[model samples]
Target: MIASFPYLIVGLLFLFGLYAVVFERNLIKIAIGISVIEAATNMFLIVLGYRTGGRIPVFTLAGESKVLVLPTPQALTLTAIVIGMATTALMLSLIMVLYRHYGTLDVREIRRLRG
Candidate 1:
């Protein structure tokens, strides 16, 4: 039960983000929710690669031995982190542009004012 705590937390984070994305009226809050979801996903990937008492996936001089944790998830998490960062930056920039044009960060206001 204790071992699954991280997974549970990640799930909660995802749900919270989803809720914010669905119900929030503020554009900034929606962007933040997207970031939260991305974080939860990255954490899930890292957790998936975790192994108890497992060694690094590296070849040793002696010989191949012992359990090695799968590196794929870690690699994927890293890549996702990079992509998420870029995506978040782009989202925020677009939000800024929207605010400048609409003079507000409320989704409804932006939609109503859209040309």
Candidate 2:
């Protein structure tokens, strides 16, 4: 039970983000929710790669440790962070454009104004 605490946190974080995305009416809030989901994913990747008494996977910098944590998840998490930043930026930009066009941040209002 204690060993699985991190996984439990990840599940909770994902659920919170999903709730915000589904129930929030404000564009900014929805964008923030998406970011939270991305964060949860990044954290999950890191947690998945963590090992007790394991050293970093850098051969040149690592000491004499037989057990090394996998580096692939870390690399993938870094890539996801970069991509998530770009995606969030794009989402915010679009939200700004919508606000300028509709004069409101509410998703329902924007939809109504579209027609």
Candidate 3:
């Protein structure tokens, strides 16, 4: 049970983020939800590449052989984190612009203004 704790937390984080995205009416809340989802995904990727007693992928002595955790997932997670940060910043900027025009951060008000 303890071994699966990380997976469980990740699942909950994803679900909470999805819930916020679907139910929250505030633009900032939606942006936060997106960030949460991205974080959960990154965590899942890192966990997938984790191994007990694993070593970094590097050339060692001729007589040394050890389990090496895959580095691809870590690389992918780093890229995803950078992209997510950019996306969150873009979303917040758009939200600010919308608030300036609509005078509120409520999604319903913005949608009504669109029509």
Candidate 4:
């Protein structure tokens, strides 16, 4: 049960974010939801790469044990973080522009303005 704690947390985070994105009316709340979803994804990646009693994959500090945490997932997570930040920034900027044009951040209002 304890071993699945991280997975459980990830699931909950994802669900909450999804709910916020789907139901929230404020643009900022939707942006936050997207960020939360990204965070959950990053957490899931880290959890997948975790290894008990694992050491860094360094050659100079050679140890008797050969178990090392997988680096691919970590690398992917880092890349995802960078990309997520850029995407979030762009999203927020677009929201700002829309707010300026429509004078509102509500999606329904924006849709109504479009017509």
Candidate 5:
């Protein structure tokens, strides 16, 4: 029962993020929503590593052993970080160019290349 709670929370986060992305009018909000969803997915991955009787992940030079919480999620989170950074930078750069030309940040106002 305890383990199921995290999954439920993660699911709710995913739903909220979905709603934010689909309903938000501002581009920035959409980006933030995507980020939230990504983070929730990452959390779910991390939670998958927990065990009922698992020990700590710390290791000593003397050969003391422990259960690793899960390195895959941590690695994936790093990847997500890089992706999120790149996406945000690209989005902001695009927004800046739009603002410079249109004198506004509203996505609806920038209609130069629309066929």
Candidate 6:
């Protein structure tokens, strides 16, 4: 039970972010919500990579007796963070363009342009 608590929290946070993304009316809020979800998932992955009472993955840090922290998730998290940043940058750019064209940030209001 104790072992899974961290994962549970991460999942819940992800779900909450997902709910906010789908339920929000503002485009900015939706973007933020997605970012939140991504962050939570990243954190979950990183935590999963970590072992019980593990030390840093660095070889110089420990004389090989201590268990090393899993590097895969840390690498993955770095990649994920980069991807998230790029996505946010793109989304914000699009939002700016959208604002320039429509003068509003509301997703519902932008639908009139669809027709």
Q: How close is every model to the real structure, measured as TM-score? A: 0.92, 0.94, 0.92, 0.93, 0.74, 0.89
The C-alpha stretches of model 3 lying farther than 4 A from their native spots are: 59-64
Candidate 1, run of 10 with poorest lDDT: 58-67
Candidate 1 wrongly placed segments (more than 4 Å)? 59-65
Between candidates 1 and 2, the one scoring higher on lDDT is 2
Preferred candidate (TM-score higher): 4 or 6: 4
Stretches of candidate 2 off by over 4 Å are 59-65
Report the number of backbone clashes for model 5.
0
lDDT of 6 by residue, 1-115 (tens): 9988899899899998999899998889989999999999898989889898888877676876788889999999999999999999999999999999998988888997757
Residue-level lDDT tens digits of model 3 in 2-107: 8899999999999999999999999999999999999999999999999888887764642356778889999999999999999999999999999888899998
Clashing pairs in 5: none
lDDT of 3: 0.92
Tens-digit lDDT string for candidate 5 (6-73): 99999999999999889876777777788789878877877776666555455443244544555566
Model 2 agreement with the true structure over 2-28: per-residue lDDT tens digits: 999999999999999999999999999
How would you encode candidate 4's per-residue C-alpha lDDT over 10-62 as one tens digit per residue?
A: 99999999999999999999999999999999999999999988876655475
Residue pairs in collision within model 1: none
The 0-to-1 C-alpha lDDT of every candidate, in the order given, reads: 0.91, 0.94, 0.92, 0.94, 0.74, 0.90
Whole-model lDDT, candidate 5? 0.74
Give one digit per residue, the lDDT tens place, for model 1 in 15-38: 999999999999889999999999
Steric overlap count per candidate? 0, 0, 0, 0, 0, 0
Off by over 4 Å in 4: 59-65
